[model samples]
Target chain A: MAAQTLLLKGVTKIFNKGTQDEKRALDGIDLAVAEGDFITIIGSNGAGKSTLLNVIAGTYAPDEGQIAVGNQDVTKSPDYSMAHHIARVFQNPTMGTAGGMSIEENLCLAELRGKRRGLSWGVTRARRRRYREVLKVLDLGLEDRLKQAVSLLSGGQRQSLTLLMATLSLPKLLLLDEHTAALDPRTAEKVSHLTNTIVSQNKLTTLMVTHNMNQALCHGNRMIMLHQGRIQMDVQAEEKQKLTVSELIDKFGETLKDETLLSCEPAGAP
Target chain B: MVILSVLPITLQQGLAYALVALGIALTFRVLAFPDLTVDGSFPLGGAVAARLIVEGVDPSLAVAAAVLAGFLAGCLTGVLNTRLKINSLLAGILMMTILYSVNLRIMGRANIQLLFRPTIFTFMENMEVVRYVPVIIFFFIVTVIAKALTDVFLHTEYGMALRATGDNETMIRALGVNTDNATVFGLGMSNALVALSGALVAQDQGFSDVGMGIGMIVAGLASIIIGEAMIKPRTVFRLTLAAVIGSIIYRFIISMGLRLGLAPTDLKMATGFMVILALGIPALKGAREGKIHLRGV
Candidate 1:
């Protein structure tokens, strides 16, 4: 009976409206996430998993819907205004951090998120110590190389740092859009483990989109399968624990007998 | 001794142009946009500052007003590109076209002479110091201050977001950074710096001409390309310093070329050729590498 941390009611998004190629990215959809909920989203291509995250992050305006984050109506909020409440880690590791800047500079930026920025002194000793402490927890040895350019880090390290940055401000909602899809298997695994640790430690409300069905089922407390821009199956902690990828596929196959569905098994699905 | 005496003047002019190069670097390098508005904005600053000074305004106040004017010009270009959805290159061209007349209107003619008027540099005359010495010192001080300010600004949270916006707009927007606002702000700041340089240059040269800004973007690009070739600094501070050094080297090259009997009218052609050479050399090297790989295959 905890209050919902995020509420989306009757959300709909249409692209190229009134054109020959008009398409509905999201149909009328409603969803609510309670505090401390970690929800995993799985969908085939063009199923609106990314679009939903985009809408919640204020990148895309919903044609019709109301989005509320902790009692604040943020449906029409501009992207800059939403920084105070939301943070996102993009799929590409390079997209989240500035490669031209040093690791410490990037960390300084994340540390000051949602705060008024001005021409001030560069990173101070106290701030550097804080960044070192935060980076040390990753156990990636990045703490020792704070002055290194972020571009020099491996993909996994960059994504892990991005996750740390996203959670730095403890936003009301954290959006992850296939955040590990671009990393190699070993690196992705490490980043995923770090993500789970951080999300649980912070008790954050999060929605993660994934192409890997096993990851969707194994990582979060809740799993939702999206089809044609709508949620087809939703399972909670116990149910999600019990559900297997094969069973989920069978359920999807039962509803939609398309050959494409049978061939779309996620490569990482066990 | 002749070269030695002219060396400082050339170096001083180069330092002044470094501010121009830094401004262009913000728009062209950081933002990755071909902003032609710098051409108009550069002279616009000089015209506004010169006219204000003639009207008895304080030199500092005139320079500030000139910077503001340049910022507005850049904002106009940004609005055309972002809100009106005009192509970025075209948006800059449109603004440049409009500002030509606007600059003339500001000065009430095609040019203004600051020869007899008291300028900001005149304050140094009150002290018993060598003429070129204080001027050179002033140039160095202003350039260093501007470069330091740029470094500090780019290190902040907002600056990181601004840099990220240029790398990938969609991802920046997804991260709750307003790409449009960043674009507008970045362009405004870039051109403001360029205009400030123009204001200072006008006073230094004793006149402002409507055509002074023509081909400025090309010259600035040359300085940047040359600088990047020499000093490859990954940090903002290093990058700004490289730009300043690059401007000096560019001026030195031009001065050397003139000293070697190159016609003044061919300066634009030489600048254009330098840019082409700078842009082409890397690609040519890359193509050679690809060919080598292909041969090995």
Candidate 2:
């Protein structure tokens, strides 16, 4: 399995437990992500893509089974404590970085992630030079505006910056949940390109959940189609590379029909 | 001549209140939480400091105790919000309500008179100090230290996470930053600074009244808004300086109002009006700009 980087074994999560309107967000799901595996997840609105990512990121506690990052059991670890090893990029660009703080200050914040935070000088000249060098790699001219507020940046620029911030310390896992969904089409394309570049350069083990089918198939080394809180189809690098959008659509249709047929068949038909 | 004589005293008092305002700014502006616990915690500090001093504790030790007590009161509010899962505003109100009784209990009454009792001020009083020199120096030293500490803390890795919690709690938690802990710890530090201000105010005024904290948060807000209005600094150091300047201007306006036949009893209303003006002005300007656009359209 190329040495698993993240593992989820028979994991389940129930929101509002014991309540009449309780939701089974995840139902005994099993997932294993190997090192350098960039997996794209896709599903309908109510499907458990986000919920699964939240569970792995330690934002939500699973009701059963176990989750591990590498060899460490992080099933019960709290969010901030896990920040040292795991980084996440949100859908909203504004949510990833502090708006009022300058780009350098935000970069400084990302650089200090997972370390003992102390009261000290922020954004020294040397640090600013280093940040400029890092930003230059984006080819977006962000290096020239190091002192500018991050809020001034465009959506694509902010997302690109967020990607840099998230990977600054090179975390063990990177979670992207519809990160470019909120951006305009052009900006989304730019951010997606940036995402591909950064992920490949860093060799980051990534889980990217996207709504666009083409995007799901086009990027990442692997793809997983999720439905009814479980993995419906898993495709590896070689198979995924050759998988067409029409093929994915066909598989999705097949899965949907199978689910409908099983539901109609019986109450306990295994 | 009278104004000149009192200028230094007013400036000193204004600076001291700026620390309190900074504390308020942390919760209200930075964290975006309406923490009513400032009202109770402020007097709670005075009560703790005055009571400790009366029992012959060193002035510095008494002030430290007061800060610690304020921290606990703030943490109490956080506990109410996080553990009890209460609404943040109500959690602050509940803590404030409880703190009134706690302050009274600590003081053994409605007030603690520290007059003639040896205090930190006493040491300065005997050192050939000018009428306002000791207090101003004390205020300057404390404000600088507090401002520096705030700047450094906000810049740290954990501090950025704290700021991130306020910016977007859900995303921050998903990034593996504990939003709950950040909120609690931030609130604790905020109220501690406020209580420290209360302790210093008690020493300066020679008495700590249980009701002294009423309208304190409003006053603090006014200072912060006014400071931002005057010198809009993007850096943390400049932000703190703006807060201090805003406080001084606020006090100066209040004193000017008093001189212009404004009643002392109407001070709270005046403060409210000032805050409204500070908050409303920017909005009004933006609205005017919008109107201009509509006319052009």
Candidate 3:
């Protein structure tokens, strides 16, 4: 067995604790992700998929849990400090890059992720050449428009650039929160393909959240289904390969059905 | 050019206040922080410099101290906003209020006169030149250096993080940069420049009055608006140049208004109106267009 890349023990997050509107977003999630695992997460609305990623990324501190990234006790590490080990891509294309900055400038900022920033020139001649090489792999012709502002790029192009930047640093863990949900179907397909290539090429441990059951099944070596705040079904390798979309949806639909029935009625009240 | 020598003292004043405009540009545009601390820090600089100069300290040393004081004031405002969770505008207002009393205590009175004392403006006195020539040259040199330094700093690695902090803070923070510290640093640098200009202006006018910095922040905003109207600021170089160019043009307009018999007391209101017009027109037009689109829908 491979060493675990990220280990989560009894992670729980409660919004508005003790208030009448209090809700448990994540309920004691105990997950251990092994090295080079690409896991796809799918669940009903408000199922705590994103909450899990946020907890792992340190965007939201878990109310009760221990999050260890690479053997380090990082339960209290803040997002900015935790960035050295993790990088994330969001659903919104604009969230990953600065619109006002040029492509080269944005890439330069990304290249220094987890690195000390000092008074040296940000984008030097040599660094620009390296960036040109890094950008050429996208086949988006972005290398030719190094000075163009990111605001001018199309949504698909920006998302592509963002994906490149997120993976540029080769972080220990990459979190994608519905990264392709905002793009057009065609652009989403292209970006999905790119995501797979980048993940496999770098051997990066990744956790991706998606609404599409087909996407959840088609990609990732492993898959996990969340209901309420707990992992309902987790299929890996041989078990995951045999599981069809229909089976996955049937299991997912039953959970939704249970939730609606559970909410709409008081069992044995009548 | 001899035109600088032949021009009225308004040009020299414009050159001196150009530093204030640069500071405003750094805080307001680059850092996207609307710092009202300049109003207090400007006088803070003047008071510190004036008092130190009177105590027989080297004029240059006094000016440096003033700049340092302004930097600290700016940092306090940053801390209030980032650490204490105070609103940026309110933090600035609080710092400005505190600085008012601090400046008063530093001066020990309402004003300090450097009329008979040797100052930076008098450094070129030994050189034979046209009247007001030395002052204009000194201010022009300082403004240019300040502009150049700002441009260079913005292109550096640390500057890139600072610019990113203002543009998309979450993105930068995700890249392992502590945004709160960046905000504090940017505020400090901005106020330091404002204070530098304040110190020089006091020496030039031969008196540092407690009220000298009133409405100064608004004036800087007006200068930036006027300058941005002339040229699009796409790069850091053009952005800094825009502030300098804007300051000169703004001064010329103010000088022309004074020549046309406008009351000096009314100048602040006039500047306020200019800024409103400059900022409002584009926004109003956009809103009107948005309404038109809604009607079309």
Candidate 4:
């Protein structure tokens, strides 16, 4: 529907290269995501889901391949250098936001991300009022407690704030690395809803890695099942909606040698 | 009479060393860096100021040069850590050791005496006040300016980035902040204040000795502990105020100990013990009261 915002060509990453324990975390892979493409990624553990996201976010450089964001060849860029165009939220709530800083301060810092930080006052009165307005979307009453340190927040609230922070600068690509995995089921559901809202509202090109099969099938316009560092299954909107949990499991069972992956229950299912 | 005699000395020492305490707090608390470079930079400042002033440089300009030298020295430590891939603590130690020889070279000896020179103290001596009053007032004004500048800087956008660099480097780096630059700047600012402190102290005491900065880190920590104990440091301004106030109180305590006949040679040991007691009490209490929960056990 739109121009390609993100592209990966023949990307491969091997951890501990040239060692006895050298493991190929990602194999030759090619992917392209268009503007406003919210793609969900699913795989068993060690299936290169996180590795793929990491390579895209510039946390781990690919052994061979090229990554382009917004038509800019960023294959050689450092993590901080790529941060101008890419925003990422880690799985750990604490990893996403600074615990020592206040909510408003955190948001203010996020606002200046990817921009030249100057000697100007960080949280001006105008910025604080704007933060209050932006935080009202969370409906967590975080606007009322802008001065409270993020450490004082509950896990779900922090994740929400982190998600807010990541999108504050309107990054070209957003990477969510199992961002809801650490939250409780109810909270996870809420965060998932918020994630969907933020992604669609901004029309952001997002790649969300999740272990939940149900979520992979339910959330995004497209679902890619990564198995053994390869795209095993790629399903589009109508086909993805028609796919069920049982069918997805059967498909995984056919190609994967590991039976341990079948035991991963979806959220809220005891 | 005894209190009057000790009061001016206590106040002067407290105010002067408040600069060092503030420097220590910046690296230790703000950046989470255990910078030992201040030890070398402190005396390095005094040596530079004392040497320059003795050679007919304006006392104020000499002090400025001392700050610049200290900033460069701190930046060297930061470069060693960030660019050279050395651990921050070891880099500071390396810088501190190297600065010893540099200080010696600058003064051409182990010490310099400015007994009859026109120093910052002499400039302030023209004021119509009691003998020690002007010096104390000068130190007060300088410390306040330094403290206020720190508070204002920490609120700036670049300052927030620096604070975040200390708070969560990974997160800030991911947000596109050049943390290496922030670290370097933070270390530089920290040591500049420490050097300023040393320059003023040397001028006030009329001498600069290579050994003056020995045991200084411990004294600074002790002052911080005393200040934190007296006033809870919630905000940036309060945190700095605590350090300055703590330095003053620590000086008073040392004076009291000396009045009670504690040997001057045992002063360092006494300060070490006070820090241990101050730091250990809360940790021991936490261990006694904090409950550990295990689910599967």
Query: DockQ of every model listed?
Result: 0.39, 0.38, 0.78, 0.84
* Chain A TM-scores in order: 0.93, 0.91, 0.94, 0.95
Model 4 ranges off by over 4 Å: A254-270, B1-5, B283-297
Give the local distance difference test score of model 3.
Answer: 0.87
Candidate 3: the clashing residue pairs are: none
Clash totals in order? 0, 2, 0, 0
In candidate 1, how many Å is residue A152 off?
A: 1.0
Ranking under TM-score, best-scoring first? 4, 3, 1, 2
- Cα misplacement distance, residue A6 of candidate 3 (Å): 0.5
Residue A95 deviation, candidate 1, in Å? 1.9
Model 2 lDDT per residue over A179-201, tens place? 99889989898899999999999
Candidate 4 lDDT, B76-177, residue by residue in tens: 999999999899889999999999999999999999999899997786677787868888887899999999999899899998988888888889988999
Model 1, span B1-297: residue lDDT tens? 556656876888999989998988788767777799989999999999999999999999999999999998998898999999999999999999999999999999989999889999888777797777788889999999988888778766677777766655655565556678888999999999999999999999999999999999889988887787787756667678878998999998888888878899999999999988766765687764422110001
After superposing candidate 1, which stretches have Cα over 4 Å from the reference?
A: A254-270, B123-130, B168-175, B288-297
Judged by DockQ cut-offs, the docking class of candidate 2 is acceptable
Fnat score for model 4:
0.79
State the weakest 10-residue window (summed lDDT) of model 2 chain B.
B288-297
- In order of appearance, the predictions have TM-scores of 0.91, 0.89, 0.94, 0.95
Q: What value of lDDT does candidate 2 attain over all alpha carbons?
A: 0.82
Tell me the whole-model lDDT of each prediction, alpha carbons only: 0.84, 0.82, 0.87, 0.87
lDDT of 2 by residue, B147-250 (tens): 88887787766777777666667645655556677888889999999999999999999999999999998888888777877776566677778778888888
